[model samples]
Target chain A: MRRIMTGPNVVLWLFMIVALLTGCRGGAPLTSWPGLTVAEGIVYVAAGAKVYALEADTGNQKWEFPGEEKKGPFYATPGVEEGLVFVGSNDNNLYALDAVTGNQRWSFATQKPIIAGPAVAGDTVYVASADSKVYALEAATGVGRWEFTTGNWIWATPLVADDKVYVGSMDHKMYCLDAESGQERWEFEAGGGIAATPTLAGDLLYFGAYDGKVYALDAASGQKKWEFQSGGWVWSQPLVVGDTVYVGSMDKMVYALDATSGQKKWEFATEGAVLAGPAFADDLLYVASEDKQLYAVDAATGQKRWWFTAQTSIFAPPALADGVVYTCSQDGRVYALNAGNGNQRWVFPRTEQ
Target chain B: MSQVWNLLLQGMVNSLLFLYDVLAHNFALSIAVFTVLVRLLTLPFTLPAQRSAKAQQELQPEIEKIRKKYAKDKEKQTQETMKLYKEKGINPAMGCLPMFLQLPIMFAFYQSIVKALANTPLQMVSLGKFASPSLSQLVPLGSHFLWLDLGYPDPLYILPILVVATTWIQQKVATPPSTDSQAASMTQSMQITMPLMFGFITMSLASGLAVYFVISNLVGIAIQYFITGGGGLLPQRGKKGK
Candidate 1:
């Protein structure tokens, strides 16, 4: 070893070659943005491997799931119904936990990662998975009631309303399934893959697809009523109120469109992709963007009212409760801000002193 | 610096997406086509490097002798090596130049595969940023090909095996016979170790990348065979193509 050159010159050459090979991010993120929701004064957010139940007002950790053993990087926004918290894990299991204690109630296994949040309707849990299947399970026991297969990955949360389940798949189709039997009622082919949960208002079903279009279809018949083009993929569920729908797009813009006509009302630009849905409360819409900012925009005008910058990008929609807005940043921290002034209330895992 | 790098990445992502569209939306096929296209485009530089490496390997025995002859004089050994290289029209530095040029492309291709697959939310968003508006519909180029999802590692371990085999064949063909016992020993270990390492890595890597490696290696083997006049895989270094 001593016979060969062993000095700064050799080190310099090695460093130069290494510098050349690196800099490309060669792998996808193993985990994704924190998915959170506010229900019953508790903010339940799934990030990395655990789901944390936090105080909506103080950002205080109430309890974290799987207290000791690590099993997942859960990214699905949790659903709370009948005292059970339903959240899906990257480990391909949907765990139903006791909402108060974070104790595991039961878990249902899927063939692949469950990225979409589970929808709890009455006594049934409807969850879509990346395995290209939708499962209907008993809410209390996690028993499989029925399963429906699709042509491709299902990333959108199942929309359950009036005994009908609407799910979107990366197969570029939106499906309507009977709630009890998991039988296909109808499916409408879209120009691209659908990732956002379909929004239902009146007789129309609204969704955004990867083809940069927002579609309105007759829910009962799966008939395409109209399609509105956006600048990029629409991954966020449309927020429908009155006759207008607000949706976000990967083109770094949030759109306001007429719910029935599919005509654009106005568009507000962001510095980065809008991956998550927007929330409306008190005439203000809270939209999260990859731009590392949670923007509070005037609902009627589509103009920014105020914004609060986080430590990193945001891809999870804000959960609004009692004038307090909760957002999960990609950095795995949750922030509570005043809905009126956009003033920071608190942040989880408080910054190091 | 990042902006320029991102532009290049976007260009690579777009090309892969375009090929996917034209190639029946088969992601695996598009990756193969993309690999071949890249190899073809870089052939001018890469071919010479391969030829130069092969030429240098064939010239190794003679160079070893010269080194031993001038073992006491470092400057004399270097001078003799240079003289021999020049006489044979082999530029020692040409090999390094092309490899240095290629590292970025190889890494960028890897990044593109990960971005184009879009198996996860974060990955999908990144892919969206780079894709042209016209290719938005292709946001998630099909990941399924036969039994393998190009976005995930092959479950049957077939692609990884192919990766190891092809890489070994290329390394074996490209390595020149060496006169020095220590040098030949290092070459032997390297020929075995490099392919194995790649295979082990491939077992966990996205099958799409494993597909890229296999295709890239097969092309490399063909070009290497043509360049070195069919250097057999098992031949000893000092006697190869002699």
Candidate 2:
């Protein structure tokens, strides 16, 4: 007694396979690292559909934006300035919320999703969007001042300093622009797309690219100073402290390099890729990895002093304010810990006790 | 079990990226080439089933005659059918094996396209983890190709039309006409519905996946033509020429 697949069986089986292939592939709304920012005893985080403002110490909810969940998810760390907090949404709009009340002051819409945080200097908010354009908006009114189009997506948050705006695009180029008029001053082409924001120290600019290379360039002239190759895509913004530059790589190694020479000093291994930039205070560098661990590596020796494991991956860079290191998990929970130890002080979006 | 599936996914992602890098960084070309390679690679599974189906189809008239002969006895009809299958060396179960083997590969290929395009941050992270380190620079492959952004849907609807047309053409050339009225009717309805259903899905899918469908169907049509001696598409034209 053997089974024979009739013609109807063949058609039915093909239909089932096609249904399984297409039906189960519903998109999950484009996830990345949760945007967590701690400032002035208030932690403003853009995770999921709402930006939550929690008390920096207790993790008690201060206020959530819009008083309702929005359609698009937000992952860009909110930029705090003046009395307003600026954050970008996957909905293609950058919203300005009052720092204390979490009330939306205004929102300036871009043509595509916003993947990076907004940078505010003085009266203007500089935003880079997946639309491949960098926009300058009036901070108070959210009116577009001017926009500069890049050749590809701009996932790197714009860095504004000394009347100059530095930003990188997936076009494999970093451009320096006049902070006021959105006019390009100079652009330096890298070997791959830049996802990490440019870290400016004195006259030198440091950043990593998808090419798995860390680069140092003269901030003013857009000339390459030196480059050090990493094992994988350097998605982290290189943290420049004193004469040392610390960066994380998708290769699961964190390398510390000489700031001026771009030579590797030491490297520390992690269990998973380090997607977030390292945070520094005192003698320790707080780094988050996709291994679900927040590591406090010694600033000088590149040795892990302590680590605190979250329930899920921690891809967002930990932020520090008032001796507290704030970290986020992909599960939408935030952990506030003592900077000296990786001990959790409180967790947000509280679980029932 | 999940880990093995991930490794298979990793293989597809790396292969696609590797192809993209070597083929002048054109993602469209990478997808088409990858689809052909996958079809060819899986031919070991598919070819046997295809041959079995054709053989079964060819013996349909004999099977019908046997059924009429054993009309008085139900057990005799099944016995005769099994005997006939043995005599012809045709096992209908061969069709089931290919379905099981090819389903996973086809599903993985669909996922690889989405991962390669990486339109979202979560997708980007997953792709980065799955892609080979040597191909990191190609993780978020350029999606732009001739008025189409592979990460997004085709606004012009050109790829959808092409997908429907190629799928319909392949079905037309691949379906063997049958004297069994029930089987012929089911095959005929499937040819109409499947092409239109896939075309509708293509309207919203990443144009890159649509490109893969169009290419896969064309390759399928070619294989089917050779396997079934040009099936039905070219036979009518040949008769006209004669």
Candidate 3:
């Protein structure tokens, strides 16, 4: 029927059209792309040309910031601290967005692409560029604090803990730098490229290398605590919670190891590869796989608790908030599911542009 | 198995293979070949879409009159519209028949590309990890295009530019004339905005999608020429923009 377009109706219609376009039969943009980041009380998702700030607890959209239509196809998850969100773009720049207003604060230009998301600590924001440079910028003004050089590209997110910043390099080295001065404290050579970030717990640091080992190093001295080997390369970041460290190997197995000793705890196998980091919430560890499964495993047992199979493989990590797990599939579907049961809550369809 | 179901399944498989073998391996060739194949596969609906689009365009004046007459009467307007469509042997759905029919094919295409090129494993065809001599024995799954990986956007941004240019050409050629002023305005805006938006996306995320878009647009142009003797269903002007 040809309905009369009232003000509310017009708004509804616009929403419906957007809903239709978003719910089109092709690929859902929000869930298909990897721009989901959770910080403070907001969950920021970069979909198409907009960045949406959603209430983390309620799963409701709070605000949507209209971004440049021709400049940024933003995939970097926003890093938030002190009322500001820092993110990178394919435009070869890092943007500091107001955490509340979603307004652009200031942007820093980079030499090449900034694929990895920005990481913030205290007054400085650390960003890894595809151009093989790790930059530390002043969080307030987007001014450069320091830029550290690496041999090859730096796509891994830089993690800062205990006054040290850890980053992996395509140059086959894991460089530990002093967070304040940006001086290389130590660099460990790997058999292959180190493309994943290191995780810190207590005095121990956990990270993966192309050498196929999940290495445990002392955060203070960079001394090797232990190294646990896997069959294939380790691309996914390692997660350390309590006494266990969880990581996925290109060998198609998710391995759980002792965080302090790097001894194998238990392993769970899947059909495909896992490139995204695992999220630990409650007693469950949630991981997205190229096998199209979001597996929730017992954090202590390393056994699969429940698995939700998506129509397409998920290369991006699944974000968990409230009681729901959010993830995207190559099938172009963004799904919200009950974290405990692995039952589908809602499926947003994909639309073709 | 049901006849329609079989067709859908086979169509999905065919699209997957063609996208990998033809599109990624040899893009231009794949686009041309697949466009024709797709057109021919949906050949049954082409005539109907053409007939419907032409009918819809022709009925615009009459439809506008009816809309004006019953503009306030939502139910009456709908009934009148349906009645008119029924009386004229015009299927309003005809224009979308080919596209609707191609849904399975499109899904399959997305699946295959994301799996094969995006480096996801769920839809992986398992092309048996081949050791490439150049890049340290890595199992290259045919996702690489020149120096940039199709799965991720290139830092240099050469592919995204090509994507925008080709997309603009395709949009300029394929967009149909709109009788409704609002629709026309929206269409115009979309034609300009979509390419720019997608160009940014390609620049940001995956260049492979841009490759797919470029090939798809070129193929679409070819399909239009082959089937409708011009630029698909859209009227061919002297130059694209006008």
Candidate 4:
């Protein structure tokens, strides 16, 4: 029996040893791609389970909401309006906090996680959730006004324009609903899922879709004005300035299209996929790429002005205010750069130590 | 090391996505098909290991006689064992090679599945690195498979139980019979402990991985049964009376 057991015993021991070694390689905590929003001299950023209010110029912590464990990570950027900061969490709750004090005013719970930031319009807040519903809540209270269910999960933030709420869903359709009654205005079917929030310019609503197309539709009637095919999925919200609409694509290129005709004007190529939407300042478009670099491009010519290499990939869109472009990277460092020349103003979590 | 592993895992991810695309984008069917494809791909290495194990089992009686003959002369016993191994054209370590080769593939599969079923924004962004543009179109793949959320643990504990049962059966079939009573008892303990440990682990991890484990074990058992001609670690019922 000893002789017979020797081989199998050795195999078992080897299995155990391998199992132990592999088991020790546990997964790291999930890092959330929480975007930054600057409002009224304060920068609101969500990291881990806390929402931090930092002094926009100095990067010093003001206060954090909850002041303790919140039990969920925040991924949606905070929307600031009327002295209140609204942010969504993976905890399936949308928190409304005092903008200056970081004190929770109210929280509205949904059936599933809220990954999209809330849009505050008048006295109502419109938010989309992964539960396949777009909820309208009373901004002053945590009471639900009404909810509009979609065919699939809603990842794009709701766009409110002229008493109408425009939103897209993974169900491959974009729905425009009346802001007051949650009544559907019209639904526009796209070739693929709509993950990017729609941008409004004049009467046209512009957005990118997973179908590798940038579409321009009539905001009121949901009629397709024109569409420009891209080489890859367009996952970033399009930014419109003047007559140009600049959008980034997963194909590692940013294209400038005429807002009216959807005609491609010019394109700037990046080293990696452009997942973050472009932010416009001083006739320059600042965009972050998955290649660990942020670039400043001329809005008119699509010419690269300057670029700043980050420590890691930049997945969140850069927030620009007061000539400083603030961007966070996957490596856990937040950088503030000069918007004109792309020089580093300061980096949070100071690397000196 | 992790970079190399990530690159290898990317290839696995692409393969899985290919299967998924072929299977009408059904995530559950893709996993089942991918598991079968992996088993078939490793069959060449496994065949040799199985033959070596069978040879080792067949030579056990002769090996026992040699051990008794050179009971006190350890050096002679070693020399004789080497001679017997040479004559039989059997490499003693051959049985281990297949298991060793499977380690990296198993890890790659685990990483690929976890990343593919990413539920958070950061995870989705990270998954973009490994997924092709075509595959990215299928983001947020439907994880529900017959009441199981592939991204989360199985609350009903059905998959975990199946994992344990299938793993126990596979281990029993693969473990060669032993002659020493203490060794046999040790083997028995292992057969029970290993499955229990795996079941416990499976209960805490994503149910998709547990599905892989159960299917892989079932396939392993089927292969072992064919290779060993129905003889396994379990004793034959009618011969037990003798």
Candidate 5:
């Protein structure tokens, strides 16, 4: 049956209302998480606009904390602990939400967008903001503990170790700040901005720079321990598993190096850039590539174990937990696969609203 | 270098850099200012676009008549359509000329941001030649306005909201009335879906581009109002000095 109103008039009216409504409610949803972190039995994921926590075993939604005022999309990974979830938003506010209820706990306002994930140590939560500052906040109260201003934007997650916090900034400086005071302990200059998350293992700290060098520095002194060269920029965080440091580079190579000496163990070449950090579980290293393929490589030999093809780019690191591996594709799909066989278990289409 | 290509590339670069710099400092305020600047700069083209749109609107009756006259004949229909357009001194494509012209500038803007804000070493290799080490140390290419980074996805989503609001207002003010049933219906569908679609897109993509679009649309409306009449929606002035 034809409706009472047909043709363009009806369409036009409908469109007008939709436009008006959408215009009035023009809020973006944070749909993608820069990284995923799991603690206790809860899994934390950051998408484009919000942070979500699910039961690690059930994939059941436990809670979701919406961002603060116009802080629409948050690519930063959420750091979770003790019923508190810490994440940053484009709204330039660092938010602390009740991990179980998804309620606002308290928020620390920043001068710029907080794209980098927050890292926690003791009572302090360290976050880097686009305003070229690394902030340390009281983990419980969301109170500003201290802030250290850098020469440029700080996009790297702050790595807290010993009594110091390490972060790389767009200012091309690798900074070691006094965790208690937020004062610069020392800063070593790189050729370009440090966008990679710093990795800590024993006495040395490792990070990739946009300047094409992977520099290892003494954790205490900030002195250059060793520098490894890649064909392109290394944006992925160095993952330390046992004695090996695993990282992927924009140069399209995933390198495995000895954690102590920074010596090359093995390298695997891919067709596309590797922006996602490598995930290690058991003896297999799982990595996602922009080439639309997820590869499972043998940790010891760097030999390909299994390869799964996706329709779009896979820049998000796969979450390996229990017996399942979770990964997201650019086509807006989240896939859960069997960790042992790399077989598909379930797929969740992205909700575009 | 073709004039269109050059305008598209250079204008886009200029627009992107200018917008980035402005929004980097203050998203809401910079977008407001950028809108004004863009509309003002293209104010001269507004009349031509308006006249062309008006001319087509006026010739709609005649075009409809032609369509009816040749309703059944596909070849003659095409020929008559051209004849009507040519005789009336109207270019059907003129209605989209400004938008088309704006394409290059849009692309250049996108390229500039991706380049300027990129943190990868590969992006840096290219940076050494284009990026002044002195400025590189100072400018992170990430814009800080209030709390959001114009370079990254907005956390609070304030910019996306503003973007949708401004775009919807612009769309409402600019949507032309249609006399044809099919065209009218299509227009209505487009009007409704386009803004919402754009709003969602802005929500998902980089906040920087959304800021540019919002500012550009608002600016376009203001320029049209001043150059034409108080409504800023239609061209009140016709070719006088021409």
Candidate 6:
């Protein structure tokens, strides 16, 4: 018995050593960043490998999809449309679930992980994947209609506007495709990768790129009208409100630019990288930074009104609705704050005694 | 605990980014440079470990004699072995320092590569905190290098095979031979199994990590060759020919 146990013990020791060496390779819990979506009094959040629906008023759990046997983490915000919740999972599946009941309606599998939320049209849902393909799927049946392959991964959310689909790719190109057929209309190449969704205001399109520049393009022709360069990569989606475009950069600065000429109107500096897009409500802009502070600044003047400190880094954009703002921190806690004063109203997954 | 880990991770990321910048933004070249740099930095500990291993190998015959003399009494065998080791100025514990030091660095490099080649918005956001102002502009670093996407697994299986081959060669060259037949066989089995296991792991992880492993193993083999005067695992022309 002693002789038999010796060999096995050596093997077990080796196994433990190997395990220690490779243990860090395991998947980390997805950062509860910006995967919060609020619609019709329900706040939908994706965290801990599941999609959760919480009562917006009370921070109570309403329902959770995929209660058990979760395939992967959710990094994209859930797109709620017509009683259906659409979300992309790192499992490489785009799932459409019933919003109220938490039942899986349908799921379409992609070749690679889906990191961007689906853009819902009337009957079609468009999503981009790390497989370097943009897929248009049937909203109800989960059947793929068409897929357009790019030169590299597509990490930006698809924007469906003016009967077309616009998406940015890590290939440093912005593609305008026919929404119905996935046919390419035009492509505009940027100096660096585009990882942020492009925002459309009137006839112009505004977006930021890893090239450290914010671009204003003519929506119809994919022509660059003007570009404003920043000190760092612009990963935050540009928010346009009445001739001013507010965008944040990893340089720890937020710039408000003129919508037409790309002229910098004003810029606000933070202590750390600004990862979240500015949330505007009641003429106040809410911006979260990795500095662990959520700053409420004057949208027009770029002057800070107030700032609230969180327990950890805030990477997700604050969602503003009904005089309340919702944001998530890297510490896995969600905060509901008064939009006007930046005071915490309540926290999700309430602490235990 | 997590805060310390985060800081370590950030340090590794910053080191890699700095190398990337210095190497003209070539990701693969940067990894090669970083591997060489790490090997050079750990030379002090590795050299002592190699010397100790050589001393242990040289004393293998004496150790075997002691084992056979006290085979019936296990406690006496252990005491005699310890006495022999101490008399010969051999510290078995010193031989493990190099490996122990490398374990954390290997894990940290894996994490740094994963974060540097982030493919999603959430990953990019998480990476934002560790990125310096200049390096942040390189977010979503280009993964293309020859036939591999650094961020994804190697599709051609080339990296996994190379990693296994290099790791096997390095282990064979670095591990000293034992006098006991059973111990020799066990070491031989581990020499084969460890590489295969790591090959399987490399097949699933990002190809950049596999690249790092290949380079690191190659450097280890070269270091072993220099320390052992090209004696380990090398073809002995005179003895073998006779």
Q: Give me the candidate number with maximum DockQ.
A: 4
DockQ of each: 0.29, 0.34, 0.05, 0.37, 0.10, 0.24
> Which residue runs of candidate 5 sit more than 4 Å off their true CA positions?
A1-34, A67-71, A258-263, A330-333, A348-353, B1-139, B142-242
Error of 5 at B99 (Å): 14
Predicted candidate 1 versus true structure: per-residue lDDT over A41-140, tens digit per residue: 9999998887999988788899999888976787789999999899998888999999999999999999988889999899999999989999999999
- lDDT value, candidate 5, whole model: 0.69
User: How should the candidates be ordered by lDDT, best one leading?
Assistant: 2, 1, 4, 6, 5, 3
Instruction: Give each candidate's fraction of reference contacts reproduced.
Output: 0.27, 0.21, 0.00, 0.16, 0.01, 0.15
Candidate 4 C-alpha error for residue B174, in Å: 0.5
Report the candidate with higher lDDT, 1 versus 4.
Answer: 1
- The list of candidate 2 runs beyond 4 A from truth reads A1-28, B1-8, B22-24, B230-242
Q: Per-residue lDDT of A288-338 in model 6, one digit per residue for the tens?
A: 998999999999899999999988888777898899999887665778999
Q: State the weakest 10-residue window (summed lDDT) of model 5 chain B.
A: B129-138
- Ranked by TM-score, the better of candidates 3 and 4 is 4
Q: Whose DockQ is higher: candidate 1's or candidate 4's?
A: 4
Alpha-carbon local distance difference test for all models:
0.84, 0.84, 0.66, 0.81, 0.69, 0.79
Best by TM-score: 2
lDDT tens digits, residue span A1-353, model 5: 01112211233244335435533222232244445677776667776565777666656777666736445467677888677888888778888888888888899888866778899888888989978888888899988878889888777888888888898988788988888998888889987778889988888889997666788888888889788877776778989999889999877899998887779999999898888789888899998998988899999999998988877778777878787787777554556677777887665443443
Clashes of 4: 3
Clashing pairs in 1: A48-A73, B177-B237, B177-B238, B178-B237
TM-score of 2: 0.92
Q: What TM-score, over all chains together, does every model reach?
A: 0.91, 0.92, 0.56, 0.91, 0.60, 0.79
**Where is model 1 more than 4 Å wrong at Cα?**
A1-29, A351-353, B54-65, B86-90, B232-242
State each model's C-alpha RMSD to the native.
Answer: 4.0, 3.1, 13.3, 3.3, 9.6, 5.5
User: What TM-score, to 2 decimals, does candidate 1 have?
Assistant: 0.91
- For candidate 6, the C-alpha RMSD (Å) to the true structure equals 5.5
- Complex DockQ, candidate 3: 0.05
lDDT of candidate 2 over A47-89, digit per residue (tens): 8777889999799998988675554588688999998999998
